[model samples]
Target: MRRVPGRPFEPEEYVLETNTILFRVFSTGGMVPRTVTDFNPGKGDRTRFAFFGDPTVPVLYAAESEEAAVCESILHDVPSGPGAVLYESFADRVCAPLAPTRDLSLVSLMGDGLFKLGTQARYVTGTMASQYTRTVRWAEAVHEAGFDGLVWMSNRRNTDRAFVFFGDRVEAGDLVALPGTGRIFAAGAGFDWLADYLTSLKIEILIP
Candidate 1:
């Protein structure tokens, strides 16, 4: 694995089609807009691709698939084996499908993209939470280079891709929520679906 390059290099670009649907698992009735890109500079927890120290350069994250979105968000901190994921974790969370109103030019963080960046997958995409500070520098570099966003293999579910779009770069009308496809993971069809999905992974949802 090559060391993370200090100087910014030209990143490979990947174009996301307007037809590709992305899933974002987020909380409802929160301070931020429910289905819109989160422009709030994150306060407490550090995130993988969030631009650090720049309120103007906010970010929004999503996954290529619903299962990948759930794994990356709701189940992100749940430990493997015998660990119980609490029902409260899903209480206000919903997965919404959204699509770009136009094609997005994103920095590709997979395949030959990593090779060009002088780093490995684990360094950029698979690091633990504690290393987010280091990882975010890469994002800052990407933002500095004026890319629309980034695309990487999900650390939680590597088979699927995860995305982060720069709020400043993605215009207000860039993404639109699809109707009738949103699911609240706490109850009804959402809960039923989550339960079955968890059963397959041998994880239980504990209600308190």
Candidate 2:
């Protein structure tokens, strides 16, 4: 690979351009914004977010972030939880990495986006869990299945969202890549920014 700049640049990146049809479903799935105002990030955060694009390979769309995104609920930082903090911490196989709660919290803080690893990512850096194996698991269904991406309808500023692109629908539209199978697409009714994008409902990676 060419020398990776401080910021890895993807020359073949694209978006769905129009995925409103799918996002309408995401909104109905209760994944929509709970509070429109909460969607907006501080002015400082918004500015920074715009400048820094997502880095996941085949990076899809970016989700709007919230100051109080209730991450603690999903990523418990306490001493113990129902599962391992970093699933990788306990993983012997590479396809089923687990990240209980604490691990999620730790990794989430390591970068700007979630579960993202670009071809340009530094040597031995920015890897969350290498447990996912596409050859043995239906990972494409999740990453490359049909879903393109999920964009948060946020009005926030700097605090931006993270994403994991699915690649099943490569022919879908304008989207960011998520390593192998992740894609980003437009799903909502008025997300004009994503005129050619297609968000995914579910993903499944094929096990070869």
Candidate 3:
């Protein structure tokens, strides 16, 4: 597999139906609203699919399931061990359920989709954080190819699919919040449920 796949190839497309509920974990303290479908402006840390040169081309990530959302976001950096996650990590974080108002056409990076692009899944999905600079170039290429977003198997949860939408292509009104479904991760039923879920994975959250 090449470090970076050639650009302008015919990418396999995946259509995300409007009925599919996507899960996203976000910080309540962040500039974007909890229930809004705003993209990250690339003002902070680098992400796997963020634009390398143009910070103006924003991105928003979501997962197919709640477990995938938590694993990909909140539990992303936590190591696989007892008490590996800190309680402070949960502060101000919340998960919102969202769905597209209309069908979204996205470039598929899984299965035969990889073959269409002349690359393997590992090169695109299994890359480490240090390789984001190289990985992001693929996103730029995909965006330039006129795709709305990219969809692939989640690195943290392979059984689930992860999605990244380009802000320049995907409008804010394209996605809508599911009414009364947002959950705050730090306290109450949200905390209790998450604690139980983490316990099943042999990860304990130490409260300071």
Tens-place lDDT digits, model 3, residues 20-45 = 89999887775555444767777678
TM-scores across all candidates? Answer: 0.92, 0.21, 0.93
What are the lDDT scores of the predictions, listed in order?
0.82, 0.23, 0.84
TM-score of 3: 0.93
Tens digits of lDDT, candidate 2, 87-191: 222122111011111111111211332224232222211222231221112222223323343322222222443333332223232322222211112223322
RMSD, every candidate, angstroms = 1.8, 18.9, 1.7
> Model 2 clash tally?
73
**Candidate 2 runs further than 4 Å off:** 1-10, 20-38, 43-73, 76-208
- Positional deviation of 184 in candidate 1, in angstroms? 0.6
Residue 80's lDDT within candidate 1 is 59
The ten-residue window of minimal lDDT in model 1 covers 35-44
> How much does candidate 2 score in TM-score?
0.21
Evaluation by lDDT, superior candidate among 2 and 3: 3
Which stretches of candidate 1 lie above 4 Å from their native place? 36-44
| TM-score preference between candidates 1 and 2, better one | 1
Better of 1 and 3 by lDDT: 3
Q: Rank the candidates by TM-score, best first.
A: 3, 1, 2
